[model samples]
Target: MAKIYLDPGHGGTDPGAVANGLQEKVLTLKIALKTRDILNRDYEGHSIRMSRTSDTTRSLSQRTNDANSWGADYFVSIHINAGGGTGYEDYIYNGSVSNNTITYRDKLHAEVMKQVDFRNRGKKRANFHVLRQSSMPAVLTENGFIDTTADANKLKSDAYLDRIALGHANGIAQALGLKRKSGSGGSGKQGYVEVITPSLWTYNTANWDDKAVIVNEGEVFTVARDKFKVGNGHMYQLKSGLYITASTQYVRYYTK
Candidate 1:
């Protein structure tokens, strides 16, 4: 399992940057929390932990130490940029770093910029405390310029934040070579099964029967096993395994 560490820039007493009634610390924390949730729910099997779950204060050293102690596979620090700059930029330590770190940083930077409307500041090398001190591959992302009115307005929307979180999750998934789950049968082919309408059965055999039913016309049904037989147009299985069939009756098929 891939272990990830999320650091939301400044918090509590320290608001790293502020502009247009938006605090950098608050925005960073919000994005980080959303990103963590997305990773946990969508990225299945991976372990995700945060340096600070709420608006709690944590120093740079403390955050790095926490990540190291947790034995994180990757560390990402989320922050917003100020000082009249516009666009997104990612920073890595400016020394002899492994190629793996550079490649992962580039992937993350590209993914984030592709989703945001901000300018692409490009990947950069810097001696930031967190990046320099981290023993694992680490990156600090300046999401956007909080000082800019357009960017600030975009940041205010939850939809935009969700897209950013998705981009972050996608990048992490790509870097870790995560596999997407196949819906059912492990292939696109719809497995064979028999459908039993209410009119054909006197009682609900599914409750007591040991056979699996693959699909139902308009409702949900549990699959019992791959092998089954149809009686009165009703399919049955071993009751131990089954595939839930989705609605495809109205879908039109065409050959290319």
Candidate 2:
């Protein structure tokens, strides 16, 4: 499991950057909290620590020291960009630090850019205090331009922020080689396949066979086969795969 340190830039008396009614401190905190949630809930087993859980002020040195002292594998400082330009960008210190920093920063930039849909301001070298002083691999992300009305509006939405969180999680996952769990899929010798369409049914065979049992559409069952169809009328065939199903009435995609 990877240990991550998340720093939501600026708090308390300092709001970092502000424009279009969006405070950098507030936006940074929101994204940081959501990023922590995505890592803890979806990644599982990984550990995440935030620099500040609330609107408390901490200096850059204090934040970096905390992360280094805690033995964090990676450090991320989240901030909003301002001063005219719009879009996403990331920063790292000049010269080589460690392979981990380079790898993590590359993945982080890719993930955030994918979700933000802002100009790819590209990654550059900077002597930011957070990156310069941190013992672990660290990167500071400037999510978007608060000064731009278009970027500000995009940052205002919960869905947009969620995507940013997702990107952060994805970057961390990539760095740690963590595979994302498919919503309805599982893998193991004892894994089961769920039929969520038509009238719920489960098959327990390595392959979908004619003798697969028909449990209630909503019912969960262990499957022996990797492939099968859920209901009679549903044309969709579930390819051989593992699934995590729930206990409830199965909702058929089509009524027979």
Candidate No. with top lDDT: 2
Candidate 1 TM-score, C-alpha based: 0.70
Q: Write the per-residue lDDT of candidate 1 for residues 4-88, one digit (tens) a residue.
A: 8889999989988988999999989889888887666555668888889888899989999999999988999999998887878
Off by over 4 Å in 1: 182-256
Best by TM-score: 2
Off by over 4 Å in 2: 179-256
Listed per candidate, the RMSD to the true structure in angstroms reads 14.7, 10.8
Local accuracy by lDDT, each model: 0.68, 0.72
Residue lDDT tens for model 2, 1-256: 7788999999998989988989999999999998987776665657888999999999998999899999998999999999999878888888669988888899988777555556678988898999999998999999989999878987887766866776887788788777555551222124333445566443343333443555553443444332222332111223443332222123212110
| Candidate 2 Cα deviation (angstroms), residue 111 | 1.5
Model 1: lDDT equals: 0.68
Pairs that clash in candidate 1: 211-237, 212-236, 212-237, 223-241, 223-242, 224-241, 224-242, 225-241
Error of 2 at 106 (Å): 1.0
TM-score of each: 0.70, 0.71
